[model samples]
Target: MNLKNYPRPFYAINQFCQPQCTELAGRSFYFDMDGGYDYELKVLTGDTCEWNIAGEEPKKAVYECLKGDDTTYMFDFDIVGAEPRQNFFFCIDLEQSLVTLVRCYIGRNPKFPLLVASEYDFGAIRVEGQPLPKKRHCLTGEMMGTTVEWHWNITMFTQHNYYSPAYYRITWPQYSSAEGSISPNFEVLAASDEISQYVKIKDKMYLYCLTEEMMERELGDSSPFRSNNMIFLQNYDRMYHVGRTFGSIMMDGKVVPCRTMFGSFGNPVRLEYNWLTAENPFTV
Candidate 1:
């Protein structure tokens, strides 16, 4: 497969298994993030694809049908199911040159849930194509080993089994959905417990600090991040999340502070004790 033809990094490209989607439906692909999927489609079809997950925005892939001298083709897209090997069905009518959604579903993958389990509050931001805020300044990070440019991207609140009635109804009906959203305002710098540390990306330097008070409120029993009766601490100190939330960009000897929060995001997940939560969701 041509790597440039795809929008983002992908795992495998197998023969299209869905029985109905026949016109040029050559492969089934898997990607960890929506941004990757969107990037892939945009490069292939030259149209912005929109697949809506968790009611956020339609960020799914789109296909454009083509008619040639002797063949009809549908824009190639991935077929996702409850598992990698399973074949979920979708159809494309050859005569009409229009693809029909016969049957489709997205399977569960553990990578995201595992990577994001503890740091659930770390929102994913897509920075590549977006413009920064007016007063916001860019910073680079230098840990004395490597100097890296840190850019602000899109911010997304990660969660598992986020509500999508139609999506869950077909993919994995047995699993229950769990939701929570408590993020730390500031991050902690644990580089040798020094009161403050300065990291530079080229000429830009960032000063860091820490905070206290991890909420003691009880999270629902069904919280996906909770494991072994302890809630996954959504610490903002994770290097990536901290770089966006707390680090102050230094320019011309003046410190430019970042925001405690960015964009108009939904309200933080409210934590309540004895929440009578449901059982954990089983991955498809």
Candidate 2:
């Protein structure tokens, strides 16, 4: 099936649990911010669906009677807490079919500091050839103090596709370790036309950085050098072999293998890769 057409922001049908049984399964969502404010919850569900928000006194019912095969629930609310505080939580009941949850945070003013948030899906059933969705979460600490109004949007969905390889380019500024100085790394700068393609299946997504060399190779230059700089990556799930390199090239005409470093300063060279397609094998 065309998994691309399925709901992507909420949950995909084949990538996560299938809605085939009657169970009170749900996910926990959390949002944290630095400013003090108030908020509200908005929920919509398919026919015969039920749900509730945590910490809401009187146990207010977000949705009780959903009517339809596909239902969408949206929660928009303010956050009221002291500086460096968190606020938000909810649970959903899916009897059949998949449920999509779209949660957004609207700050009361422009003073909301880095809004941190996350969501947990409770009692999710395991399926084959599919990966469990990544917990929806974000944490942007005090580095981004509350000064400007902002909105945080999180979406979850489920879907499935064949295993494919992808590529990525990580660029950093150039630095002089001996001199203890920093400068822009011209060699690692991306071209204006560089674009990235994301292959997403369910909660897993592989990001591919399309470089000029890769484009040239794909267009028909059967050169060994082109194959040496290409790599593939798998970015979702807990897989160690998420990426593979085509080796490395020398900055002054020598050849060397690429090494992974935690910091990105002084690195004059960047990496590239070849993403697998339905018609092409990763090794090619």
Predicted candidate 2 versus true structure: per-residue lDDT over 107-206, tens digit per residue: 2224321222222222221233545333322211211111111011112211112222232222221221211111122222232122223322123222
Which candidate achieves the best TM-score against the true structure? 2
lDDT by residue (1-284, candidate 1, tens digit) is 88656674322111111122233444332112322221112222343233332334434444433222122222323333323221111122233222212121112225321111111111122334544222211112232222122112222232112122111101111121111112221112111111112221112222221211111112212222221111110112222212112222233545333222211112223322222132223222
Taking every candidate in turn, the Cα RMSD to the unseen true structure, in Å, is 23.5, 20.5
Top candidate by lDDT: 2
- Runs off by more than 4 Å, candidate 1: 1-79, 82-262, 265-284
Model 2 misplaced regions, further than 4 Å: 1-196, 207-241, 251-284
